[model samples]
Target: GPAATWDAVDAYFGPLVGEDDVLAAATTRARAAGLPEIQVSPAQGRLLQLLALTAGARRVLEVGTLGGYSTIWLARALPSDGALVTCEIDAAHAAVARESLAQAGLAGVVDIVLGPAADTLRRLVDEGVEPFDLVFVDADKPSNPVYLDLAVRLSRPGTLIVVDNTVRGGAVADAASTDPNVLGVREMVDRVVADPRLDATAVQTVGSKGYDGFVLARVR
Candidate 1:
């Protein structure tokens, strides 16, 4: 089974990425608090860290902060003075994430914005904050296109934008699929492809989370 194989692979290679007590604690706390276990897997979190590091990202904007698992990973990629702002609509999740981020020693570098992502993003634009070096969109899947547009608005040239859960086990290839999540991803892909200001690609991934993919775009 793919699920069993994926688990075996992760078990074998996970240690290479090394252990993370903060990440483990974040997941554990989220479970204890009865939060959804939909946070990215450890391997996926590491991939986000790698992307931020490779892009030389100093300022990051994340559209989701589920228990701060990925937030810690991304924050660790930043310099001591770098900052990250993550948006979460669920007040309970935000509360849990704040405590986890503080436990990870990232409270000084990370900011949690509570409210709908669109509203928070609009507020950021209104405040005229500096463009981010990297943006991660992992919130409501049906709003992928909107998030991508805002990611571009909040970014300068050379900024990297990563959107998770784009593939959905290859359902994106089915144009007739009526699933809002699938259609949302498809629309985002099509919009990105036709955009003149971005260069992007989609990569299918398999992990303990099963098969899915992400869109990686660089603002031009």
Candidate 2:
């Protein structure tokens, strides 16, 4: 389970948002094609869309590009001229994601970078790309803190930074959990809480995707 609260949130909102048959069909196809778990649930997808819109995000950075489900959500929220840069380590997955985005008519709005996420992020910084209005971190768990650092560096004041799977099925809340992923999430949370440049909060939720949690921070 990702987060119990996610279940409640989904129950409340799921009925309100009409499902997109195209997106649903895409998800089914991706699963049948043997792609590992990559699609975000409809609830989470909607949340991503809402976040992008709320931030008025013109340029967004996504630390992970799974099957492009979330990319579609984010890209759809952007203005016609807006864009998103998404990083994916697996070339095959990136290719599939590109196809998925193209199917959604959102390929033009996303730039997929295929490589180690750390290297890709560093390259973005080195290239002197403009600061992003929003950043969503959902890559390797052990590398979360490093991702957080880069996200901060690439964000301007008021920029929103959202971290997915922060709670990690409640392992994050159990002190006895020695998992490196749990420890990394704890460290990241502490760092965000103490950082003078950001205001942060964690929200727990549950849905068809199971229990999941996310940490949202606004750069000050």
Cα lDDT tens digits, model 1, 1-220, are 8899998998898898764888899999999999999888899999999999999899999998989999999999999889999999999999999999999999999999999999999889888899999999999999999999888999999999999999898898999999999988988988899899999988899888899988999999
- For all candidates in order, the CA lDDT equals 0.93, 0.85
Model 1 lDDT-worst window of ten: 13-22
- Give the best candidate by lDDT: 1
Q: Which pairs of residues collide in candidate 2? A: 1-211, 2-210, 2-211, 2-212, 3-211, 3-212, 5-205, 6-205, 6-206, 7-206
In candidate 2, how many clashes are counted?
10
> Each model's TM-score, in the order given?
0.98, 0.92
Global Cα RMSD, each model? 0.8, 2.5
lDDT of 2 by residue, 132-176 (tens): 999999888888888998899888999999998887777899888
Measured on C-alpha atoms, candidate 1 has an lDDT of: 0.93
Name the top TM-score candidate: 1
Deviating ranges (above 4 Å) for candidate 2 = 1-15
What's model 1's TM-score?
A: 0.98
